[model samples]
Target: MREFKTENIEVAYADNTIIKNLSIKIPIGKITTIIGPNGCGKSTLLKAIGRIMKTKNGAIYLDGKNIYELSSKDFARQLAILPQSPIAPEGLTARELVSYGRYAHQKGFGKPSEKDKEIVKWALEVTNLSELSEISVDNMSGGQRQRVWIAMALAQQTDMILLDEPTTYLDVAYQLEVLELLENLNKEHGCTIVMVLHDINMASRYADYLIALKNGNIVGTGTPKEVITKEMLREVYHIEADIMIEERTKKPTCISYRLNNRKIAVEAGIKKGIKVVG
Candidate 1:
């Protein structure tokens, strides 16, 4: 298993810093998720590790070698990133976009060789986009467009995939399907997956390892059983919640939660003679 590790990386937007001196390990071949409130540096940190954003300080290492030392193409071969908003140019077919994933493997003036065509075909089929391969991106729905982008990422055939809010457009069914696909990739191919998720319950449900961030600092990091708790939720999100262990999935599910009206809730709980975290 290839270890993807980050060490004290700092990222900024001009003079304002978004990701502080943060360091975390993305366990090889496991689904590691970064979860945090809005504007809490989740996306920024993902971009830095993907090399989509420059780190103001520190470095990211893959298998003990600094990622910055590798060539652009070399890095692309091992890691692929699917950003939240990927631009699809006008007149670009779904097939054309997925084929772009092969750019790193191409030598000079890539004209789509037999191997490239096969890889593209596999990517489309895996994403269930074979029927839509020739369709214009403009003609597809938001969910279909998102799947097209994911298909392009899959075509890269990397061991690690970094995604930022990958389930933005999908309904409940598609959302579950996409998450299942990620799990299958990890189980079948030993692919290390890292993503940023806003949904606390979804993060807890799908993530094998969870990294919780609050205001550019790590609130906690552990398995869902250890990380998802009433106190952690209260501390991270300032909410009162009832945590329950699901009998079927054995996942911790937060049922009822209310935002930071801590004193009132605490007082009410005390008056009712019940335990509650303020």
Candidate 2:
């Protein structure tokens, strides 16, 4: 299995630093979701780990080697990233876009071998996109297009896949569709899936592990039960939440939440002998 970790990495844009001295180790062959409030560096952290953004400090290691030291093709062979709200090139068909995932495995001139074609076909079929293979991505529904992108990542045949907000803008059904597809990948193929998600309940239900972030710092990381608590919700989200164990998933679920009176909550925690961290 490939080992993935970040060691105290700092990421910045121009003069503004977004992530600072953050570190995380992703569990291999499991689905890990990152959740945080807006502008909390969830996307920035994913981009840095996926090598789409350069970290000004520290290093990201994959399989015991620094990622920056690996050849581009070698890195691509091991990992694939699907960014949020990705736009396909105008008029590109689903099959054509998925075929591009084979580029890293191709030789000079990048001609597709028979094996490459086979893998692409398998990806399309696995994503339930075989019927839509010839359809232009621009013409498809949001859910179908998302699956096409996922099929492209699957075509890469990598052990690890990182996604930023894979469910953004999708309706409830489509969101569950994409998440269930990812769950199947992990369970059946042992693909390591890391993604950023906004839906806290969904994250808890679908993720084997959860990383909670706030203001570029990780507030907690562990199984959903360990991390998704009322205390964490208050500290990370500045909101009062009622959490319960979901019967179906046996994971923590936020039943209801409302605006928090930070001072009152902190004082209440103090009175009840609970450590409150913000």
| lDDT, candidates in the order shown | 0.87, 0.93
Q: Residues 73-102, candidate 1, lDDT per residue (tens digit)?
A: 999989999998677999999999999999
Please, what are the lDDT tens digits per residue for candidate 2 over residues 9-69?
Answer: 9999998998999989999989999999999999999999889999999999999999999
Q: For model 1, which pairs clash? A: none
Model 2 stretches astray by more than 4 angstroms:
263-278
TM-score of each: 0.90, 0.93
The numbered model that scores best in lDDT is 2
TM-score (C-alpha) between model 1 and the true structure = 0.90
Q: How many backbone clashes does candidate 2 have?
A: 0
The residue-level lDDT of candidate 2 at 101 comes to 92
Off by over 4 Å in 1: 262-278
